[model samples]
Target: MVRNSRILIVDDVVDNIRVAMNILKEENYEFSFAQNGGEALRLIFEVGESFDLILLDIMMPGLNGFEVCKKLKENPTTQEIPIIFLTAKVDVDSITQGFSMGAVDYITKPFHAAELLSRVATHLELYHSRELLLKHNINLKAKAKHEKNRLLSELEDSQKEMIFILAELMEATSDETGKHIKRVAETSALLAKYHPCLNDEDVDLLYHASPMHDIGKMTIPLEILHKPERYSEDEFSLMKKHTINAYSLLSHSDRKLIKAAAIIAHEHHEKWNGTGYPRGLKGPDIHIYGRIVALADVFDALTHKRHYKEAWKIEDAVAYVLDHRETQFDPELVDIFQEHLDEFITIAISQ
Candidate 1:
């Protein structure tokens, strides 16, 4: 295959070109010629990756072969075009310099036609072999990536199903009714979509990750969670541990969604005024994941009926959030949430 490859010849010497062309053409190779490095560059660019190998002469006028080779290596499109120097300079330093400038091999002038043809055939064979190897590597990487993504999708689906079953089971233990975790996930996603710092992928991560916010409640006793009255100091102290429990439950994984879940689990109960439990983290000290979920959880709790109280109207819930913007919630997020209230409500109702 390589003997039949197209070879470009660059030399200022006319006799050398004729001799090499005659010898290589007999071996079934196609030939293109250039008188100097400058003309060779123009011809190579015009051909645009058509030649399999280049035979460059070092001592040509106006941008010698080394200069042409340097330019070709700098261009990603042309860099892989193999170059072999055909030069008269036989010194070790000259040969090393040509190889360093990206020549695959060098043949000194006063060269035998047989030697030139043999070197050309060898380099072309190497080039084709490299091309095959690169193609195989690319195919292998694509297949690996596809398999990884497929497994990731399956893992995410399993987590969602587990969350739904767990959330429903926990809700059954308490007095809450219908889609509490789903609503929080939807609202968190809605708020994140309009957030400047969050991209589409980040928003989706938060959306899926937010439902795990109360996952710690699974560890809390049913009596406390179902209590129809206010929590006693002892019960409240125990309740605070849920945040750490939440973090611990999801913190084991290094995945982005799991990490986001950990942040939400640990920080959602924190207050803007530094009074929140588990950590007295205040204001922007809280992770945006935590801040976003706090609002979602509160809004859903306010608008949904519980064993302890009737649901507040949407208007009343809005007023409550607006009233406590800096005290109970992150004010910037609160404002964005309020601005997109209709979208949030629409998602809530759909859920």
Candidate 2:
């Protein structure tokens, strides 16, 4: 009793078509009629609407029922439309040919009304059920993809938070204030943005990793780390070891952000002219991450008051960085620093 279902009744005899429609009239289904196989094929092809079940005659002039069924089955567009053969032929070979031609079942002529109604209802119900299942499967897959993305987003946030907490803990061991770490992170990201070779992802990684550049200072003795005056020759030598110490502490991590932090920690103090300690890596030999952070670290340190020195004027800090362009820092990085000095000063003032 599916009122929405559309059924096609095809027969060369007009009386037979009327008989079939009358039998199905109680169900209130929309009906269509074709007098011959050729007309049936044309109706199915030209009609914008689809037929739910096709009741087709086996023998007719111009393209018999078997021929129409075969052609419909061969086409992808109409292949899944169920076809039932209705004919006078009751011979074994006739039924076999009907089945072979993709008919769902053969209903011999003089068929019982109950039998016709039952088979039509059965196939229509099956078709609707199959459609529902396919839609359910599509919805399930979409939900699964959404959940996967949500979990990944949460994991990334947790990783970034852990990195920041660890960097703060390392800073707690020395005279550096937490604000210094924040300013260095901002400055490093700003510099990376202006560098032609770095992409947006690289800039983000530097922003998070620059805070740990002096994590090695945790390894220095508390007395030397907190001293209010310049370090003695021996004291300075021991203090320089913090860079290597920071590297050793973080180098074994497999995470990309942690690896970047380790590189920054190890080489941020290395000079461009090879005069720096702890490997003395110079110029292009120094990792770009290290070179960028080196300039960021010095600029922030110079402008901020610390246990060992009072804060210098912003102008003096700017001049000092410009003077050391190719000796203490990468020339290219120094140029970027000068170009974006206003933005850098804003970051320092903000923190």
Q: Candidate 1 residues 155-260, lDDT tens each?
A: 9888767766766776676677548888998899888888889899878888788877887887899888888899999998887788898788889887777788
lDDT of all the models against the reference?
0.85, 0.88
Which candidate has the highest lDDT of all?
2
Residue range with the least summed lDDT across 10 consecutive positions in model 1:
169-178
List residue ranges in candidate 1 displaced over 4 A. Answer: 11-13, 36-38, 45-50, 56-119, 348-351
Q: What is the C-alpha lDDT profile of model 2 across 294-341, one tens digit per residue?
A: 999899899998888889999999999999999999999999888888
Q: Which numbered prediction scores highest in TM-score against the true structure?
A: 1
Q: TM-scores of the models, in the given order?
A: 0.80, 0.73
Where is model 2 poorest over a 10-residue stretch in terms of lDDT? 41-50
